[model samples]
Target: MAGNTEPLSPRAKLAVTAGKAAAAVSRAAGRGSGSVIGGRVALKLDPDLLARVAAHLDVVLVSATNGKTTTTRLIAEALRAAGPVVSNALGANMPAGITSALAGGSDARYGVIEVDEKYLAGVARDVDPKAIALLNLSRDQLDRAAETRMLAEKWREGLAGSKALIVANCDDPLIAWAASSSANVVWVAAGQEWKDDAWSCPSCGGVLQRRDDDWGCGDCGFRRPTPQWALSGDYVLDPHGAAWPIRLQLPGRANKSNATMSAAVAAAFGVAPQIGLERMWDVTAVAGRYDVVSFDNRDLRLLLAKNPAGWLETFSLIDPAPAPVVLSVNARGADGTDTSWLWDVDYTRLTGHPLFVVGDRKLDLAVRLEVAGQSFRVCENLDEAVAAAPAGRIEVIANYTAFQDLRRRVGN
Candidate 1:
């Protein structure tokens, strides 16, 4: 039932068939892609559908506060070098979505799954993946998801005594501590740009001392582990000290870190670093992140930033000043109801740019911008915001629901 390539049982076959029918009806009715609903239907019929569908495949679960979707895409692309790969490329990362993806690609040799941070333990337990990539953990969706430390503790407890290889970011102390319980770990210095969530040591609850790129807890012996793979500028250095250039179409150092971790994970599966990087270079965008779509005679570049840690990275990806940056946010169930995390971002970074705010939570964003001493115009919608900007290339940064709204409007 775990790792064999046996044919699906009668119950699982019926469940998968019913799930596919539900997805088709949902899509025809224009009610979204229906991956979530399909998986829901499947699970209702067979509770163990995920395990049964994933039994034959070599699974890799990718989880993080951010970049899990993009990282999942990157890993899937690299793993394709070996054989067919199945992944939830649309960002449906929970149990239902993952089951849909795996069930859809029953013939794929590898399974690269993007898992929600809160559901990682449950998904990992069900899938029994060959590798689990612990990217980085930070405070996100605090109203719904567990607190940063609590999630880390869950990971440590959930993954204890697992046979899967843990490819973790050692730069993040929380991630380091969470992945520490695993017997097999491939430490990667993937660089943590946002450090607010890791001020305290997860081990002894003492203050973590940081100097340059190293971090340690003076009270306890827990510290940054020596990594076998490291991201150095534009290249990734392997364990043998050979530096391979990471020529990726994805922008920013964050993506480079993702690529490095992906390569390391692929290498664990016998895929060479050079081969993996070569395959990864073909990925230009993941689920419309960093996608440039033309609307109203102007090209709108889409960027998704859901939390403070995500906003920090989005700021770095914004176009230079005077490009007219549009900020949008929504506090729907998908996006955490509490918008307090907006204040944690440094919006002053957009001082020189022409700023436009729009979305269901645009007022909340406007107040945060005002408090940060930045000027911005409030618009009724994305069209109003884009029309207000000078016709050319514009940068649009939005949270979960807002980004999807604009993405749909632009026909992307």
Candidate 2:
């Protein structure tokens, strides 16, 4: 559900007017790429504007290393079943984008915001959301974000003080440790497809022991918390052990985990899990992610992978043996200046798929693929790469900026 576009208060009206004007000016001048500048202008006009807007709405704040946008969308859609809801639709997860979203939908009673993993604590403090969904915490933007343990500790501290109901993924040890201290916590057994970032225990500097689904620390008593809303074998298991059917248009177990966690959040707001799952079926493509578009007589499915964990999860959702797959990589500010993370991804899985590499860091990916005994063709231009690709449905997996560039090419 979408919120009212009109602002209600004089101060909010002034801020929104200025922000919208700035956004229009930025778009006209081609200076601003997303909703960031408008948010910046609004916050500059009123430093406490986010707090003020939040005071009138029931907020649901979502934060994660990945899947924040999609999770936010799920929660927003579920909440819309009750009434109008506002959310950050673009891949913007910073304070400015959040403020812009809150301001844009001032008439809405529910605000579902996707805050950046690094900025979660600060935004959570101001928004005081009814429920905070803490998805998996993993290594992302190593140059920008702090260590995973440090972030978990920060979350632990933030959740310790907030009265909000914490809906967290218990599969990740870091996320479990982070939300362990929250008074009102609803743990979800959302599967952590990648555990590379949480090999060690965040508490007592001990090695976390894993035995199938359970995890514990021998050095300390800390362990994986039992989930209340658990997902087991394609069904959402409630606290009472009742199984509920879970289906989604979104592919992969990661998305199923996202939906399970969102179902818990929706339940907290009086929406039934069945209703949430039903709504989730309607959201196939989110912000150009997992979007299949017809281009140049070919069907191209777009997927964004910013880090090794993301790449690992996204690669499993595609089948590229028949057609050539486009792998785009860029080392821009948004994509992380360090493309060294490419080495962490398992390019060997792409051996069967004819690889067409593009972007500024295409050569780096090409070398990695070659090292993995995979053959690749480097094309500087995506159009040219597509032209050379096998005539069929192609999967184009790209990093942050590269994914956005491809989205623009597909007219998203």
Writing each residue's lDDT as its tens digit, candidate 1 over 1-412 gives 3459889999999999999999999999998998999999999999999999999988999999989999999999999999899999999999999999999987888999999988888998898899999999988887998989999999999999688999999999999999999999999999999999999999989999999999999999899999999999999999999999999999999999999999999999889999999999889988889988889888889999999999999899887887899999999999999999988998888988989999999899999999999988999998898889975589999999999988898998
Error of 2 at 264 (Å): 0.3
Q: Candidate 2 — which residues are off by over 4 angstroms?
A: 1-12, 30-34
Best by lDDT: 1
Worst lDDT run of 10 residues, candidate 2, spans 1-10
Clashing pairs in 1: none
lDDT per residue, candidate 2, 195-266, as tens digits? 888888898888989989889899988998988988787888877877878888888888888888888999
Off by over 4 Å in 1: 1-3
Candidate 2's displacement at residue 43, Å, is 1.0
Local distance difference test, candidate 1: 0.93
- Model 2, C-alpha of 152: deviation from truth (Å): 1.2
